[model samples]
Target chain A: MSSDGCSSPSGPRAAVGDRVVPGPGRAPAGTRQPLVRFDSVWKTYRTGAEPVHALRGVSVSVMPGEYISIIGPSGSGKSTFMHILGCLDTPTSGRYSLAGTDVSSMGEVELAEVRNRRIGFVFQQFHLLARLSAWRNVELPLIYAGVPRHERRVRAMAALEQVGLANRVEHRPNQLSGGQQQRVAVARALVTEPDLLLADEPTGNLDSRSSADVLAMLDELHRSGRTIVLITHEPDVAQAAERVKRFRDGRFIDDGGEGR
Target chain B: MSWWETMRSGFDAILGHRLRSGLTVLGILIGIAAVILTVGLGEGATAQVNSAINSLGTNLLIVSPGSSSTGLVRGGFGTASTLTYANALALGNKRDCPDVAAVAPQVQTGGNLVAGTTNWSTQVIGSTPNWLQVRGRSMAIGSFFTASQVKTDANVVVLGSTTAQELGLFNPVGQTIEVGTVPFTVIGVLKSAGTSSSSTNQDDMAVVPVTTAQELLTGTPTVSNIYLEATSASTMGAAGTEVTDELLALHGITDPANQDFTITSQTSLVQTASSVNSALTFLLAGIAAISLLVGGIGVMNIMLVSVTERVREIGLRKALGATPAMVRRQFLVEASVLGLTGGIGGAALGLVAAVVVPHFVSNQIAISVPATLGSVAVAMVIGVVFGVYPASRAARLAPIEALRSE
Candidate 1:
């Protein structure tokens, strides 16, 4: 009787699954609304007088608790799509909304605010500041958001605990293992408690074991009703998400068999 | 983040690159220090010169012979040969020039003064008791020759402090010093007068009666120079004119342009010295300002490099929702802090230089606190003025471009 309703503790561990049920602490059904919406977005880059289209006129909508993946080849615009969704760049032409508010026409300051409040990003490179410790890195977004000192520490520590990185909070990125660093990056992204989490190739640099561990954490987060959109070129990584959209030459080749 | 947090983070980043930051600050430090030291030294020299000038009494005048041309060949014009002992008697008898307090007619002869084994080259000046009042001098021991001594042509002399020291005359009041083989008893020892108002040598001289000087040294009834003291500064112009007319009539020179003597007052000397000092100070300050300009360039160059290096950090902060103003403020704070710190250090360095250089060379030089403060202010101004462009560049960077730069 979980929210997603495909229950039976079937993925990796049924014993540990029974201990922590999926969607057990989530909001009731029909309470949360769609937070991110994309409508016929197109992104084109001009190189030497020749325009290269990166994203065709494609549209998709993501609800509050959906875990979706955009999978593609190397030049298939998956990264471009992630950049647009993360508000790091605006679409060349089209409407994009977060929490039903149109963000396509927003200025740089407004866009930055949207990025801070609505979308948290986790990059494959784990861009935790090299000089700062895990806790300080987690505090970066809050610092930008102008959170006071005492509250920033409290929230950053809470985020680290949620990623199981509480013990490694004081360690710098260079001092931590790859898995530990990725976890710290995740904690940083989650510290702001944004409405959507956009991760680009979260496990691209990890080993099989570390990849599995990362995937399991993503699955757990998805089940907890935290919306996650992951971009990757690997089918195995795409399969970890509940829905997958395959992109080819700036267009969706298939919406992963219609999410069925 | 709060502005304090941003500033703290920026400072921490700078601290992380210790060697580079130190090198950059060192350029500014040198620039500031150079400015301070140069200006300070100039100010100290000016003060010393002013003090030395002031040490000579202000109410005095010197009359020297003016240059004259005879058929385009410049030569010393012989004038007023008859205004000798007769004119001195006439000046002492005048009542119209009441400010004429004292007048000393001098005839000088330069030769070696011998005292036992000590043979010192010195000048012998012939004058009466009024020479002390005219020349503004005081005796450390004994007394100058009286009017009767000059009238009688007594073979007595007064030694200058330096001349006395060289002759080893511990009790020079009763000692006999030989001037050009003519033995003369020392009547007085002049006190130490460091330097005259015109920076002339006053220490190496001997004083004797005008008649004795004419008989023993020059063997001529002629005088070279005359020292005059006015009763009050208010009547100096009148006194100078009276003395000039009297000398002109006595010498039978009717043409004013053909006058032989030049008369100068203490006011003119002080005025000329002040103007010259002001010009020299301006020249020195201008040179020191060039160092501040160079320091400003250094600050600008370092700030530009810092902006480039911190591009990614700027992008990251922008992505996290920092405004352009915030980014600009952070860099500006860093630059201004560099300037202010360098200014303080430069001020301290300049003050130290001001203090030490004068001590080693002489104690006459003095550096004031206002000069040090001025240099520090200039350093800070240079910092802010040059720091703006780089800070703006860093702030205006597009987050997308900066983030993808890596």
Candidate 2:
């Protein structure tokens, strides 16, 4: 099933800005069971005209505590993979298991539980509720997890502190900079302590400085044994992870990131 | 999510769009207030009808001469001299009309009362001494004339309180008063029955003996009205029938429809008045229902827009693990909150208008607890009903597609 092309990782990418924190190296993927596994996943969407194959027979696995990035241009299935990884969408034909639980054919309610307990997502648009303060935004996931108010506050504060946004807890989205907003989103994702953190174009809307800052923040998270799956179109942003997997036309071109 | 959290978030969502939410609330406000006012007015009208009928005394019926047709032109009831004092006396006989307790025959005329040179034009009614008992009237001063007074054609007049006041007489028993150039001694004054909604003044007439009125004034045997009191309240219908049969027999009309007089009962009068009142109330209530429907549509329209505008927010919430039920509840709660706020505001406004409007309008606005509370409940139900589509629409959205939408 291997592509048998160049199994070499790309040469070190050019830095877009000054990187504050060094990325922790990849965890050895062969020793323990993978936290996420996708077996021949396929997603087909039907419209008035032709059925679009957003993902076609893509197979991959993400080991626990490993940081990985999927790189692809627009319409190259990377975003689809991120959606499937976050349990926001299900594969039309495939087995998708998160933490050894098969969730591919689960109902919407079960998917929601998985998304709440097992997956956390950072969107390209930051997706912070415009009306809520930073801490309020961070505590949202725990709210859905049925956490009590006092405990939700405590965990949300800890998540924000981990993201180095402890001081801007009361500031709303509009009051904070784009980097701070994205960091607050990351804190929200982290507050649930999910098994997988899926980031879809996390720095897409930011300038180079902010992008570097968010990347460094992600790097610090990865160093602390958090499993992260980052989707990106830029080579430099993809380089923030220890491993990079390229995708095109709904198929992942394994550049030897899948250890045999 | 807990209901408290859902509710807090729903309230927060409404507060986020104050102007839009307020405008939506205003629609329901006007609808609820209009409904309340119309209901109050209808009840007030019914109450007025009831009180007016009750003031006419219980178990009584009036027999009036039917319309007369002369050369193709017909007059209204009481226009023909078909009723007489003999018919009234016959009704009072227990063998002829067993249900009839007491009968008063009266012939009325608009005449001037002159006492101490202060002249007042008022109705002069000629009736028997039983008029007071039949009409449920009591004397405020002096004594009513006796049966011997009617037999002797005595010119003794009993003034109503308003007539006595207008004619400059206080305690004018044994006083002299001129009834259209015929001098009469005032024997008593009737207590007032107070002002009513009808144009007829109940306390502005004078009563005298029928014999004296006919001899001294009309020179006619026809009487205007024959008031009959039933033996008991339960026999009112029987009493009315007895009076009609007696009058028809007395007039020598064999066919019931060809009778020359008409019997009027308080029950029929109240029924007719209240029917008209209820029809008006129904019309007003229909108008209010339309407004309420429009208000419900307004809530739906705003909720649809909210679902559309916050598509991304909804997706984000779903991605954060909110169930479809949770999303639906949130929107429904928001709609109910709007409806409840508007309901409270409208109820307050309507109750205030009830208190303050009676001073300006002639009719009282009765306070109705059921209508008030029922309308508020209806508003909330309207919110929930209209919210269903929009809330489910928000709930049915696929999280990925919603998040991807701009």
Candidate 3:
């Protein structure tokens, strides 16, 4: 049912959904450097007087154009892991790198630049600004990137088209359905063409049909030689990935094997 | 992002909350309006007083008797009769004082005037034919009493516009009116001179020959005051000094301070009026400026509330690659727009008040250009000054924490 072993091993190959043809197969982890690296990362939260250890000495790595899922129940540090990987939050201690850049020790400004250029985040809530139109929401990242007005509009429209929402460009969030809103958010994330697409429960708030649609879109993105790291507790959602890492009580219990 | 786009987005944010922004702007509007209105009214009052002082007489001087002190029981100026027609004649001599233009000696007293069944209380001023020339007055009807009429002590008088109106005589020339139980023929009616800078009505007196007043009305030969005009405004100081010296020599008073006669010039009167008006203007404007400070505080309060309310928006923007500086610029621009709108609206309101207020008040109210400009500038400054704390607070917010604020 899944199109496994079809991701391109080379840098940024074009992907046309089911029509996409596989390139030279990726090398094994032992023979190549990874695009994402985490060395014994720990995340602690000081809510009040006592500290809660969210992530305890966890380590993981991801390669380019690889689809992976990090699955865990609530309080298993899965969300914290996604936050650190997206550069939204830093580790309490230990080194982390993305696209060969050390991001663990970066300041807020530098991290923000790294997040803008290298990462695209899709949240469970869809996080589309309610006031802006669908295309305007998609154009937001380009605006921050200092893209000129005409080019930002063109690229935003193109990205919306990629998500099959070309006719809903002028629709506001409230005017669109849940699945369409998620698609618009996906378009927003894709507009920047970042190296990593980190989705934290991208379909958690949608109905069964909408959730299926979002999951299928993510699978299609993975088939198109795009990197996707989806965080979810649903087995059905995680099963779509080629590989999976299971987390329990802030520790990874199972690192699924790679396959071709 | 570019500064233009940042400003545009900030304006959009401000527009999103119209009622809140409007109320905030109203506070600043009242403040700026108060400042502009007060300044306009003050300027108008000062201008009115200055023109009134100018119309009193051109380069004229009034020499009146100083106070008489009887063992510290002092009597006010104009209470003694040290000035006389002889001193006036001496001052008017061309060889003695070429700077002196015209001289009109006068003795004044308040009395009742009766014509037919109408009666009015008015000031009766005794003077010569040169009264019109020295006082800068013009005859509206017949001529003034000639020199021969003054020497003969003719019972002829010239009625001022107000006095004529009071006596119910529009054309008073050749009409008879009783002054102190003696019938006097009105030879002329003086044109309206309006009011003085001191706010006293100038056209409420009747003028008669000085000899007629001394011999027939007051029954005394002692004159009370002398009016002298300089040939040119530039020569007033020299003319004043010459008149004082001539009076002192005539009266045999050596010390200048102890001289019984005192000389007051038009220039001094104008200077005094201007200084007093300027002080009043500053006081009024100062009181009005306090409201502007309060308006600034209002702006700061609104901005702080806005920053607190938009924490999530701030987080979203920060996540989208906006720098802390960019965030600060956005809020600052929003605050400035609020202030600019309020300032311009208030200035327009003040301009309307400047035009409309004169209809209600006795004095003219005028909008001063500098004050209008300054009020706008002050509003802008208040915006920036109050906007900083809130903008900095928004800029310093951590993205993760702010996003979690819901």
TM-score of each: 0.83, 0.91, 0.85
lDDT of all predictions: 0.76, 0.86, 0.83
Tell me the tens digit of each residue's lDDT in model 1 across A1-260.
Answer: 12221122333222221332223333333434356656677898986698888988766666678887888899888778888888888888866777778787888788888888877877787777888989999998888888899999999999999989888889999999898888888888888988898888999999988888888888888888899998999888988887777788886775343222
Considering the two chains of model 3, state its CAPRI-style docking category: medium
Model 1 segments beyond 4 Å from truth? A1-32, A44-53, A223-225, A251-253, A256-260, B1-3, B76-111, B127-137, B144-157, B194-204, B209-212, B228-250, B265-287, B359-365
lDDT of 3 by residue, A1-260 (tens): 11222122232121111132222343444434456766667899898899999988776667788898888898898988888898878999866778777798999889888878888888887877777899999998888888999999999999999999999999999999999999998999999999989888998999999998998998899899788998999877888787777888776775454422
User: Best candidate, lDDT-wise?
Assistant: 2
Ranking by DockQ: 2, 3, 1
DockQ of 3: 0.54
Candidates 2 and 3 compared: the better one by lDDT is: 2
- The ten-residue window of minimal lDDT in model 1 chain B covers B77-86
| After superposition, candidate 3 runs with Cα above 4 Å error | A1-33, A40-58, A91-93, A233-235, A248-253, A257-260, B94-99, B110-122, B137-198, B203-205, B222-224, B230-239, B254-257
For model 1, what is the error of residue A59's alpha carbon versus the real structure, in angstroms, after optimal superposition? 3.0
Tens digits of per-residue lDDT, candidate 1, B1-406, equal 5668866876876677778766666767777777666656556566656656554455666666665545666556444333364555455545744667777878878978888888898888998888877776789899999989988999899988988888888888988878889899998899877774335567768999999998888877767766677878988898888878876776678987777677788778767876786787677767667767777788788889988987887887777777787888777777776777788887777677766776566543356677777767776677778889988998899876787677
- What lDDT does candidate 2 reach at residue B46? 93
RMSD, every candidate, angstroms: 7.2, 5.9, 5.7
- How would the docking of model 2 be graded? medium
